[model samples]
Target: MIDRRDALAGIVAMFGATLFAPIARAASVQVAVIDTGPPSSAVFTAGQRALVSALSERVIPTTDTPGAIAAEVPQFIEKLLADWARPEDKEPILAGLGAIETRSRRDYKVAAADATPEQQDALLTLAMNDQLPGGADFFDKFRQLVITGYYTSEIGITQEREYLPVPGKYDGAYPYARVTKVFSS
Candidate 1:
């Protein structure tokens, strides 16, 4: 008869092997092309889509790895807003995008997407600090969504962060200095 503890450990070990297997990468990954038709019932307009892309990229810019744009986070956000979010849940995001544009045009005479990187960063900083009226709430939600989308994407999981397959025995005294990229969990 298998003891409960022994059975549980066996099950965990079995699943862990399957779950932590290394991913296979293709030389050219094919991405689905979304329809670029008129926005009759779409959650985001063309301009709003552009704004979301720009804002999300700013949140996770290309450093040593691919950024939010490369990870398709904007498309993820659009799908979430269209399929999952309630009307009330989307109002703040739309309002925030408008506010960002307003601030950008007022300060730099250009839209957020057209503004320089420095200008975009400054605007993001202002929004983050709650200096932009009616924008703080939007920033909080948008930033969370961007991060969630990025971290869940393949580029984020495998490229930006280190992926450890089948973690070894626990070492409580693991040296922080030896740690390079953050481990994807």
Candidate 2:
């Protein structure tokens, strides 16, 4: 018997990461409870957790709206990894994290979590574009996990995207200009 969640995870894993965006958006409102605990415990060590937190924040930084940290994306990721990921799925992430720390220390003379935001952003940019030799694979998975975790989070649904529980009648001719954010049901 195959679990639907596993199927979904496998689907996401198989496709290009960009393909998951609509799925993430569609699944957003269905998210029930977000774990509100210390993000460091099972999947990541304290230092690793800090790195995850820092990296996630850089991935979805705090602008006027709250960022990934506020959405508890790191904790969500920790839970996902501990509960959902297999050993094969886990190894790249672990290796990727190590690479990030290695780069940070070598380039900035500090751990990734302790590096300045600009420095961290630079590292993330490298990973994002596949410039970091060992980091691209990790960043791809990490970014997808972060996004999936975030959109399903309360902050992402309620704040980053708009949510209206009992929405008014739709206007067929509503101007795109009037739209502020993506609406979540």
Candidate 3:
């Protein structure tokens, strides 16, 4: 089992932090629910959910391994936002979603969902750049949520990576390839 805190910290470093003022204040109370299933009640609105799904699938598209959608990353994110994320974190999260649309319009002269995949990808790249006005924080937070949710999902653990329930005797001399798929417990 991985320590999620460590995992998040490492992933957060994947993109630099925003030096500007925080768009949304963080809640003192922590409210994350990584366990259980997709939210029983919807957290984001229909439009928001759709945007989240698009962003998630793009972030981790369907390949040989199950993609973010297959792993229920969007649903998981919604649950985290609705049930777990701090109240202050919510506004910025939603703003991040809206920022995609805003960027889409600016770049492609169309709604984010209406933008072509290539165009959307371009916008996402901008988000990743940390140069977009008021969008860097949202991008970092969204990226963290997607990565965390996907890796922790059943499909991510089993289909994407090897999972060992019970280990046999330790084999110090086991032949291993440097590129072997990671195994998770």
Candidate 4:
């Protein structure tokens, strides 16, 4: 007794729900998707934001130069996630954040952000050392992405890491110590 239009609508609704369920569950996913070619309707959830914030904090904590939070690393990560990564890859990224949070909560009796610098370092080291629960490959990918994102930022490239764009046309015969000034990208 179902009309063709009704059946089509039901199918569409189901498809939409399935596609957006993870995004809806985590708002950060939408934020990640933002500016990365996804529609504006896709939005990040509280948990997602927390995850992004935590990851950013760990990657580049508040220091004399600047931290990941200040450089908007969360937004950067979100965009990369939505634009560069495949749909199947997103869950692992989110789960990586969740794993860090869960581990922090269990080990330090606090959220990842709430943990001390030493604790944060320990967690990051552990994550870097061991295969994450979600998967070893996913963890490695996430770490690589985070490091790449952090180091590529303006503050990161110029201040934190050595970045040279021109190097004054590259003197092939110049002495190593003579090149004192670094270049910017």
**Cα-based TM-score, every candidate:** 0.71, 0.74, 0.74, 0.61
* Candidate 3 per-residue lDDT over residues 88-149, each given as its tens digit: 66787787777887778787898787677787788788887865666778788888899999
Runs in model 2 with CA error above 4 Å? 1-41, 168-172
Against the true structure, candidate 4 reaches a TM-score of 0.61
* Residue-level lDDT tens digits of model 2 in 134-173: 6789889999989998888899999999998877687788
State the TM-score for model 2.
Answer: 0.74
- Angstrom error of the Cα, residue 2, model 3: value is 14
Off by over 4 Å in 1: 1-41, 168-172
Question: Which has the better TM-score: candidate 1, or candidate 2?
Answer: 2
Worst 10-residue stretch by lDDT in candidate 2? 15-24
Roughly what TM-score does model 3 have, to 2 decimal places?
0.74
**In candidate 1, what residue range of length 10 has the lowest lDDT sum?**
12-21
Q: Which candidate is the best by lDDT?
A: 2
lDDT of each: 0.83, 0.84, 0.79, 0.67
Q: Report the C-alpha displacement of residue 76, candidate 4, in angstroms.
A: 0.2
Error of 3 at 144 (Å): 0.8
Show how many residue pairs clash in every candidate, following the order shown.
Answer: 0, 0, 1, 6
Residue 137 C-alpha lDDT in model 2: 90
Clashing pairs in 2: none
* Of 2 and 3, the candidate ranking higher by lDDT: 2
In model 4, what is the error at residue 121, expressed in angstroms? 1.8
Q: For model 1, how does the per-residue alpha-carbon lDDT over 85-146 read when each residue is reduced to its tens digit?
A: 55577888888888888999999998788888889888888888888876789889999889
